[model samples]
Target: MASLSSLLPAPTQQVWDRDDERKAKRVGSALVVSQTSVPPYGQRKGWVPRAEEDFGDGGAFPEIHVAQYPLGMGARGKESTSNALAIIYSKLTDLLPSEVLAEDDPTLQKPDDEDIQDITEKTKLALEKLTNAKISAAMPVKAAPKAVS
Candidate 1:
């Protein structure tokens, strides 16, 4: 059996401390985004609606209802609050070594039949398990208020 170290490639890169610091500074400045959202009720600049609280509204929360690609929060801080951590979890697992990555966690598992039906079924099942309801049934169905005569 081959030892794990033998399978790995030796690092060939040199550390450039100064260059790394400069790159960090440049990237930090470039990606400097204000991650905090507005409080549910208040007035301030760049204050969008309090997304954290509003997402919990009983009237079918959009974040909970819709299936977003990359699932979790769009930005960094939002991940924990979004209830979309599964997406991030999946991504992280994908970056792990094959030996450890072969676990049976549904999130880390791949599906067979790379077709629309299979994808749809898997997505529906995942959403059902997560939300504890049939995906379609979980959605708010509109019944036109008897045409206000």
Candidate 2:
């Protein structure tokens, strides 16, 4: 019998455990947050005074912010709303028995031969009807008579 690990990709061979070590390591990394503001320039004042340390071109803010979170955590934010939903979904799915999960999934079931034939016939009839309708709706074009040289 083949081991379950053998069935998984090499990188994911060891990720089947309840608490994935890789996920834990990722969660352990520090998360940093920063804010940036672009000062407006006026004819009289030139550029508004900003803290020397806080000042940066528009590009620096995103680079610093991305380096801090790296995984686009900013979109998701600290609330972890999506993460919580994902965890809930995973838990719900895990609670279902293997047989229920496998059998209840619509994509796993194959259509009967009769069902396939019926659908194919219906699709062909619909296409034919549409083609006929288009042909009927088209206006006949008259070719201009050739002029004598």
Candidate 3:
């Protein structure tokens, strides 16, 4: 069987180091805020702004700005928090692998439609299962006492 690297395309004519340098610079400045305190229950109707910060100066490079906020307290809040964390995790992990494998050759072709479809179907089924479990958990259950034998 061919090794994984053997399947990849030859490195492009562009300088790999230059691309790595750019990625390093951008990732070095990337900021991720986590573990922020949630607002009191029903204190605010929806997402509440907690803090905001700006970085970099008005120079050759544009400044970067970020706003920090926590979801409200309840089911909606929990879902929002979960989505926010997922996004942050995806962004961070997306950068991590590239940084480690910056020198690796790029794939010659995009993923086939069948592969994408298969993944989508699997994801949908998994989500359906999770939703079913959550629904079952939320439902009230009755317990029957056993009579003496």
Candidate 4:
């Protein structure tokens, strides 16, 4: 199989775990809550979390890779290529489980359809709250007026 880098140049490869450099590393934010941040300016700014730095122990967290698509003719170019790589990284990272569990654990298997629906509904509600908080956090701060000289 062709690597994501094969699709473009200067691909940004992030590792949630550094155990192996040859394979992809899944970055799970749930693993490292305290280290996460949203900085201004940059590919991941505004809620972008760092790979290994933001994720927790490798033994527990799962990893995924997400890449972004380009917007113009240069979409296939270097910068766009990097952007695509980042998109892929994000997608992959997002799919990872919050924590790894034993295979023998029955809880690891998918639940019944009704359970699934219930889980989905709960997830949606949780996401709604999280989104609201995130939007509130992203709001710009107002500046105080200066006195005339």
Candidate 5:
């Protein structure tokens, strides 16, 4: 089977989950939080001349970069994405029972109703909140008063 990348003009392969390379190793900011304005930039008269050496680029809190799968591609791409999203949906969102997820049951095939992974991103987020996944932590809210006080 051909990967989605093969069809592209310039195909590229992605290597996911290299936390060791991306995370900060020995940055000052990683150890200590320092908010310094270094002579307030514009004040030329009394500029306290100082050299600050920051070895690390604050990789401890690296910005997340995600590449989402194309929705309306083709059967091959759809199958791949469906499999991926199905796993996440089943595991994270608790759509399937623990037994099913653990491969204890033989009902792992895609359901006939709909492709579980073929839903919109919005629905996925909602599902995450519903399952109380760490990625989509739901805030606590008090119930509204039913009648007037």
Candidate 6:
């Protein structure tokens, strides 16, 4: 019988220093983001009100998944977030009637679709400025200082 480690596609690359100061600072930053982005997402910055109602808004659900990781904070934060989200998606998939999951907990699926040629951005910075993305922001311009002659 093969060991559990053998099941993973590849061992996680240890590109980060576990005791780095930046990592600790970023963890705090992540927690701050999580506190805002979860539960009441209505008041988040730039969050536009939608016509349709959202799920779990009644506070019926006890808890929801939020990013708070001891490892993989700043530099690789997106990767960690993506990985955690994928796992949650897998569980949701498993619950669906039509979906077929090989492994219940972590179903290994291709991050990219085989048929499409879409490029997946691993980092948030690249995604923030993706070619087809449209974003706009403008601060109020103070009226040109009153001209006194």
Order of models, best lDDT first: 2, 1, 3, 4, 6, 5
Stretches of candidate 1 above 4 Å error?
1-13, 16-22, 28-34, 38-149
- 1 or 5, greater by TM-score: 5
The most accurate candidate by lDDT is 2
* Candidate 2 per-residue C-alpha lDDT over 1-149 given as tens digits, one digit per residue, 9 for 90 to 100: 99998998679444467568778877987796455555443332333323433445322343232233323344344566455445354477777766546666778889989989999999999898787666655645453333323
Error of 5 at 50 (Å): 4.9
Segments in model 4 whose C-alpha atoms lie over 4 Å from true places: 1-109, 141-149
**TM-score, per-candidate, Cα-based:** 0.14, 0.26, 0.25, 0.22, 0.17, 0.12
Sort all candidates by TM-score, best to worst: 2, 3, 4, 5, 1, 6
Which residue runs does candidate 2 get wrong by more than 4 Å?
Answer: 1-108, 141-149
For model 1, the local distance difference test gives: 0.55
Candidate 5 lDDT by residue in tens digits, 94-143: 77455326554557665554555556656987786656554233443453
In model 4, the Cα lDDT at residue 5 comes to: 75
Regions more than 4 Å wrong, model 3:
1-108, 143-149
Q: Choose 1 or 2, whichever is better by TM-score.
A: 2
lDDT by residue (1-149, candidate 1, tens digit) is: 99998999986997669988998888779566656543443344343333444334323233333433243345455535545455454586677866656477887666656766888989998786666444445556673222222
Candidate 5 error regions (>4 Å): 4-20, 24-29, 33-36, 50-149
User: Model 2, residue 143: displacement in angstroms?
Assistant: 15
TM-score of candidate 6 to 2 decimals: 0.12
Q: Scored by Cα lDDT, where does model 6 land? A: 0.45
Task: Report per-prediction Cα RMSD to one decimal.
Answer: 29.6, 27.6, 30.3, 33.9, 31.6, 36.3
Q: What is the RMSD, in Å, between candidate 1 and the native fold over all Cα?
A: 29.6
* Cα lDDT for residue 31, candidate 3: 94
TM-score of 1: 0.14
